[model samples]
Target chain A: MARLITWCYKNHWMTLTLLFAPLLLHGQVNCLIYDAASGERIACELSLRAIQYRQGSRNSQLLFDKAIEVGPKFAWAYYEKSVPFFKRGLLAEGVSLINKAIDLEPKNYLYYRAYWYFYNRSYAHCIEDLEELYTVHHESFTNTPGGEMEMRMILAMAYAQSGEVEKGIEWAQHLMDTYKEQPHLKGQYDHHILGVLYYLNNRPLMAAAQLEKQLEVNARLADTHYYLGLINRENTNSTLAQLHFKKAWAKLQGEGGGHSPNIFEGFNVSAQDIEGML
Target chain B: MRPVSYLPLIILLLTFSTFACLQSQANHQPKYKIPIVTHDLSYIPFDPLLDDPNFQICDSTKISSGRNRLQYAAGRNTLRSDIVSRFSPQSAYESFNGYIVIRFLANCKGQTGRYRAASLHLDFSPAQAPSNLEQHAKEVVMGLNNWSRATETNANAEYSKFINLKIKNGKIDHVVL
Candidate 1:
């Protein structure tokens, strides 16, 4: 190894290649894992101890408090301490704790804060964090922490929910276009959200086209058929609407449940909802 | 020159490896742990209580019916809308917009009570709304007598639910279940 080092030192090209290796690796790596310093990483272990106790219990929260005190810069401690507060309806306390964590390490904790923002029905705030995470910080996303749906899906859906249906269509369309040829790699119901957005935009032709593609990608997603049925009815195609609604109802009640309910889903057609339509 | 001239380079490469391996190790480990621990030597139990004096959790074991309980939740989304429609115009409160999260329990016989509530701004910071805002929400929630008693393994089961209401311009805009 020493001989190779000497040879590399002798050749400027070899020396330059050796120097660039770390930078090359850095580009390919997800920033969150490598963003922490070794000291903060050790501090996060204290949080692990806290979680071993029952969540939201006195002991667990105390341990989390201790972790925060001992490793004040360790963002995970603040993030961990905020969780129970969020779950138990202490939104202010939860938001304060998570904000500290995000301030310490924005890349890692922004997704979590955005997730609660979505739940709290603060669609604008959710969009702000996600837009920052995606556009400003350039963080690549796969799903929310709960594995419900892609963050892009959340972005597009939030746009629609926030009354920005045009932006929603642009974004959802962009996501589908990116993964169009690769069906398996698409989000669990990316096409469904797009189809719903199209229907909401009053473009029944595009809506029907997206729903047709949705049937091919995720036939089991009952909400897809439910929205498809609504579109068919809107277009005065009662026969197809009836057919789609029946499919939606059957798929909704089937053994596996066409699609397991997701909190982040753009649309969920409940049995009660379908009953009225049927 | 000695081989030690490259020591900094080697150390830099090793440091890079350390950063790469560290959090990925946490990712590989199963995060699931039995979370029902009663005590630990290092534990210092001190959690603030936000509950009515008469309220007590009926079951801790299945308490996490938690997410599953959401499936059987009754009148959450619907009742919230009714409260806004019936009560909003009558009360001349200050214009306020944010969330009101109410945490309470339902007992085995479909009895519900013990409400603890918090109000927050849209960005989720602590904020004050008109007293009537929270009062009206609590009244509607307490008036609800139709909650279904859900039991997975037994007939009598008690549970807790958090009802999050988003208020916009002094009216209940959305109910988050």
Candidate 2:
């Protein structure tokens, strides 16, 4: 009986060790470098920016690929890969990659943002993604007032573009009104919304004011000049209109600017004509 | 006689324990001596008159899983060389909504080299798939493979290894060497 007890003890010990072996053997896989101040993962953020800015899609793609290769389970890499695809008109691939990202990191806001941008482009599609982003990450924007303002401006634009012109106007007005009182938002009003609203309301003067302000703040804002040019042309200010038009054309040159004939028609401009002006 | 029988059993137990300890130690062993390489470039220039404003440099080396730090030195020269090689004057300012392929060689140990290819796919997110996504991917891979193979065949070549490359959308998201 004593020998039997000893044998059982030995077996029990071996079983315990075997069961815990894998857990103990698991090593730290990788370390991500991040900005300590922002608590933003440096590599992931840069990857996102690369995709967002369309700086080097090829390089960004490689970086994300490398990121995933190094950490197959990392959700951000998949999310990063989706952006360039979506921007370059590869919607299906973008959606698939974004879904993968959401699956891997269900709680991440970045994944949701990617999806939001996707559906926001077409109003008849998934509006829920935008709502989800607004609800889940409502607080993140509040912390960064500038970022919040920018996001609100984008959301307003998306709403307007999606054909919810009334709702878009409402959001835009809300952004302008809410931030108007704050000193921080003094110069950063909802110019896109303001421009769109003035245009929609048939107030060309107001629309031009808002858009011209946007251009002044950032000359590289090609879309602003494009819209301003449209308004200026409608107002019959040919020289100023031409200037704005020329700027838009210069900014959009060689970017497949006229690929979407539907969107370009509204501008009443042609790529060839714009090139001629340049 | 029974005590003598227990001797072999003890020996067997001790030997098994030693082997297990060695295996665990090997598995947890740290890589203490990894080779390091540094690349430096002066500048990456962009011609606003001819180059897309959105163009930026990417370091393909950073995509590796090894403990090597890769960086691209950004300035006028580097940018000019890269853009000049990849684009034409007529198409220089064209916004490319496609991927580019980059290849690198991995030198392992003292006298061995391995070729690696990475693919970049660029596109917007959260929508239905784009029409040209697949074709772009195929072209990127083909370009990388062609370049790597061609480089490998040339003697006294700048690049001696062949790495397979692929791109999906406009980004390079996969690499296999």
Candidate 3:
């Protein structure tokens, strides 16, 4: 013991550094993070962001797969892998992966969001997940800007789709009013979505008004023109309908054209309606 | 040699063994290394919200998957360059402008086949029309076979894409896909 003390004293700086190394190293570590598999976790997050931005779903899938291979116990990897599958229209594979994710971590609210809200398109199930996250846990997704608004939008859409049009309108109206003056928050509030909700409520005039308001903001969209055309056609205004439809077709041939058919547009207006009626 | 003389050697061996054991234990323990993120700017994806006009449904507006859009854009740019090299500006009326619309199926394998060209419209208003401008445009378009292959996530599905070329003053003005 005396000899050891003498040696430490002789090399005090080195000894001190050795003694404090573990403390300094571990200080920045997040307790919530899986310390054993941080590399995989980072790769997983990068892959998720890439896929979300449409960077390359196939590459993202491979990255997710690699993450899972490295950290087999990571529940988020399975959840993320399911996203690419869903994007690719492989619903069965996506559902299976989501189920696995939920099974691995039953407490994860995002797993439920992916399965119920995004994949199933069941408003009730989506609402249940949101309610559970907001009421019971309140630990997920409340910190980000517009997170609360997004929750409200989902709930409003859910209510509208579930035959509670009045409740849905209440939420939708609140959203629109809140973001009305904040034109920069266009990423959050969508007039087309609000217009669709009004249409679902069987108020065609109100729907047209909402969509026209969007056009006033920006009229460069062919989809909006086509939608207005459909609304006018429904109102039996052949002249306005034809005008909008012709404009839509002309815009479709413009510089930024060749977009996919709107899934929602298929609900009221068919491709035949555009080609034939126009 | 005296027995005490071997004690120093024994202590040195013990010290070495201890260090080996400590390293092995460290190898088995959980290591938390900070992650490093490197962004590659070359593979940036297209933002569809700019084109789709439906910013609210941004996720659904994704017509093409991932790097395919970037590749498609690159291909269209190449097509414009190709047309510029082939199309003879002197053959058309001075300052003449027109558009040629062509539709083709880009199959799952990223191969284009069975191209169907639409009727060519010449917009030489006050300027006299060239006799064989339509034929020249058709030949130029039909000669194009070099294209960047599109990647589709859905198994064995074909995608049909339209290529619109705006020709002005006997040179390709813009190529829209």
Candidate 4:
């Protein structure tokens, strides 16, 4: 090695010229992983983390641009960045990013889950992702208490949305049973999801029961009253329906009125619904 | 002749009374109150057209992500709730629905300022405009600190943000970002 270095030192100008010639001609400084589109290197973990910090701003989009510039192959960055775009109502951009993320990491169930729900709106795809995540790749994701509960909720919703009522009911029941032991964990959203699932699955009695459970937990939600009114109306109980509707109306119009923040994307419960009933 | 003398004295008294009334009228001036919307400008000054596309961080050509967008909506709702909770208007009369639109400047550093009411279309049961609610909205907007700033090249670049608060009856229905 020493003899070779000594020999190269005598021909340093030639070597320098050869290196400069290619760089000048190609207009490319060779990055280990170059992205032709962005004329930059691929992203790494650090780049992805940087993007996450700035995720709160519109500038985060540009940081995503920069992340892709540094590490185009970093699938997580694409997934992380897609969420903000979707929240901002840029569905197309979000869809494209999630797709790229999934394509790069096809086995990543979280990416698929995001893609199906946020980008494609296909419940079947969501079911597929959830099943694969739970059964095939259970060890991959961090299964904290909150994370596990959220996963179950997602699975339940996916099944319900995909017309698999029985499976949806089973999962929702599983969720209820699991959390029932811990009273503090049984939140309004849990009942809301179960109630919604039962309603969509043609189980009115069960739906009403679950919705009523929400009231027991906390009666502040305008949604609970509105939904109860809807269920009563379906049962042809005009007086009961009217009562619930009035409650909901009061809650919405009165000083202490408010709705649950835990809302699903496609499931809409609005004040307009109450107005239409009245 | 005595009656004629009394008529002169009465005429003089009437003239004095008229002059006193005119003087009082001149002294009493109508007081007009101009409402003020408070705001903080510690980072950058606000621009008139904060939501201009050329200077916006999230412009028409691009979009915000789903999570960030959701968070922004939630933040705006919280602000609305804070204002409404602090000064809730009465809602006993009839059904009502409308909105209040506010425009403000948010720079790249996430600081907000120069909050102005774009429009206020609130209707209540008693049929009086809720000046308190409107003021609270303005105060909330002005009180808002570091927001995610626009990434536009201009250092003083501001993103124009609009918060449309929908009210049903006297309660807050929802907020549109």
Cα RMSD of all models vs. native, in order, equals 16.7, 23.2, 25.4, 26.5
What's the candidate order when arranged by decreasing TM-score?
Answer: 1, 4, 3, 2
lDDT of each: 0.68, 0.43, 0.52, 0.54
Which pairs of residues collide in candidate 3? none
Provide the lowest-lDDT 10-residue window in model 4 chain A: A139-148
Worst 10 residues of 3 chain A by lDDT: A140-149
Q: Candidate 2 residues B97-124, lDDT tens each?
A: 3333222332221111222222222322
Model 4 stretches with alpha carbons more than 4 Å out:
A1-45, A48-53, A56-75, A89-92, A100-120, A139-149, A180-184, A234-237, A254-257, A260-262, B1-177
lDDT of 4 by residue, A159-248 (tens): 766678789878768767866565534444668778878887788898999889887765766777888888999999999999999888
Q: How are the candidates ranked when ordered by lDDT, highest leading? A: 1, 4, 3, 2
Query: How far in Å is the alpha carbon of B34 misplaced in model 3?
Result: 26
Ten-residue region with minimum lDDT total, candidate 1 chain A:
A23-32
- Every model's TM-score: 0.74, 0.38, 0.42, 0.46
Q: Per-residue lDDT for A219 in model 4? A: 70
Q: Write the per-residue lDDT of candidate 1 for residues A160-223, one digit (tens) a residue.
A: 8899998988877766676657543465567677778888898888888887987765587778
The CAPRI category of model 2 is incorrect
Candidate 3 wrongly placed segments (more than 4 Å): A1-75, A99-164, A180-183, A230-237, A252-269, B1-177
> B53-137, model 3: which lDDT tens digit per residue?
2212212223343314324434444666676688776754445555454444444454444343332323101123355555566
lDDT of 1 by residue, B8-96 (tens): 89999999999989969977833212122243211222334634454444554434326336333454445555555555534454578
Candidate structures ordered by DockQ, highest first? 1, 2, 4, 3
Which DockQ values do the candidates obtain, in the order shown?
0.14, 0.03, 0.01, 0.03
Model 1 preserves the real interface contacts to a fraction of 0.30
lDDT of 1 at A182: 52
- lDDT string for model 2 (A1-278, tens) is 99877876756534444554444331222334543333235445545544543322355566565555555555666665665444323344555667666656544533244333433233323334445545564522321111223344455555665666667666667666765565344333356447756787677887888877765544444556667777777777888879877777766553423221222112233455455544
